[model samples]
Target: MTAFTRGFRLHLADGQVLDGAEFPSGRAALVDDPEFGFVTGAVSVEELLLGYHGARIEWDDEALLEGKPRPTADSITSDQLDALLLKAARADSTWATALREAATVADGGRENDCGCGGCDTCAQHRIGLELRRRADERDGGRP
Candidate 1:
């Protein structure tokens, strides 16, 4: 059996501890954590740590089967999902549609909200009622 190395571990807000591992999109055999670590994705290690603290998502480091991505907001695209749907739509449409819809609901709430860093309705401010409403709506009531 293949052995794995240990890497950065995160203590999640929900009392779950996740370890970082690396894999090539999981089509091959499963590997232990520490091979790829969490640095292989667009989201940084700090972002994953913060997500753990913020309770937005949860993950683990157990050897994953093939096809399990690095697990991040930008890991996959709606188009890729659409393609998969096109291929598998006939299998079951209800759960697949809901998965696509719910999984994609957080797309617009990316890190581009503060593009200018000078607007009155800046990402930080949200002081006024309108700004707060907009921000809340934009995040899908997540925050």
Candidate 2:
């Protein structure tokens, strides 16, 4: 039970909710739910609207169980940076070559009990798949 400096109840798009928090104590377990996987840092409503990770955030209100809420970040996260890299891969000169050599293979949609597009498995999962695709290409189809 690490003391969290801030907390929030995340309302997913499909009626599921995930509660989380940041540990200024440097050891908050609340933010890393086994069900929701791992969520680090703070995100604002504006950034959530971008669907950058395929999930919308409830920005109208917040549920802090401990500390004050911080505003949206002034910079992008490393995951966001990776997403940008993947996006850039789309426009790269070798895209056509890579596509022919290693075209995408869909995972047949969500492979979970809740596939309504709200759970971390559904929302954050897309980012993982996309990143994996990028990785496969970068690794010359080794994966």
Q: How far is each candidate from the true structure, as Cα RMSD in Å? A: 16.5, 19.2
TM-score of 1: 0.20
lDDT string for model 2 (9-87, tens) is 5555666666555455433222335565876443443443344344544422233211323433554367655755676
Q: List the residue pairs that clash in candidate 2.
A: none
Task: List model 1 lDDT by residue over 1-143, tens digit each.
Answer: 11322244455566655546333332121122345643334234444444344542223423331234333445557765675556454444444444344433433333334355654555333333334344444444533
Instruction: Give the whole-model CA lDDT for all candidates, comma-separated.
Output: 0.40, 0.46
lDDT at position 61, candidate 1: 28
- State how far residue 10 of model 2 sits from its true place (Å): 0.7
Worst 10 residues of 2 by lDDT: 59-68
